[model samples]
Target: MYSYDVKVLPKNTSLWGGVGIEKAISSNSLLICRNDELGVSLKLFTKNQDDGAVPFGTLAPGETYIFRLNEVTLIGAKTTDDVSDSMVRCTIVCPQSN
Candidate 1:
């Protein structure tokens, strides 16, 4: 996962999954995880609309929202979640720094 500066702590709460910003320099499949002071489990929408669409507050075009390393899905060139909802169409980024 890309190292993005964050301001919020990982609180134990349900996640409302959504797609990624397509016009971003970097894009990846984003998964919302839930941890209620117990083990961690990813939260997904019951319907198909939320399957990949990023939340409304995520990486909006021209707007950058800081996010934590929720998780990484693909690795090779750079590193990203392999998200399909991203607006930009580019190759996958594999993690190389660490």
Candidate 2:
């Protein structure tokens, strides 16, 4: 039997009202969608700044989107529904060996 410890890097965060997460993710990091509702719009961009933002599509309630971002630097999200100020919760995970 082989046993190993997996370390989860960084803390989970949430974005609301078209705001960006305070912490930027390094390229090829893992992004896990925790909770999303009210038609949240997701955007991902590179660290180059001038690269602009890339639309990563939207997610609904009880739905999850998980992916290993490609050269992703920052991530921003907001609600696309008729109502004002929506919230989306996401967990950023980077696997590290013990």
Highest TM-score: give the candidate number. 2
Give lDDT tens digits, candidate 2, residues 2-90: 12221111222223112343344445456665433543443322232345555666555547666564544455454444343434445
Q: Each candidate: what lDDT?
A: 0.24, 0.43
User: Looking at candidate 1, what is the lDDT of residue 24?
Assistant: 29
Top lDDT hit? 2
Alpha carbon lDDT at 18, candidate 2: 20
TM-score of each: 0.18, 0.49
Model 2 scores worst on lDDT over the 10 consecutive residues at: 1-10
In model 2, state the lDDT of residue 49: 34
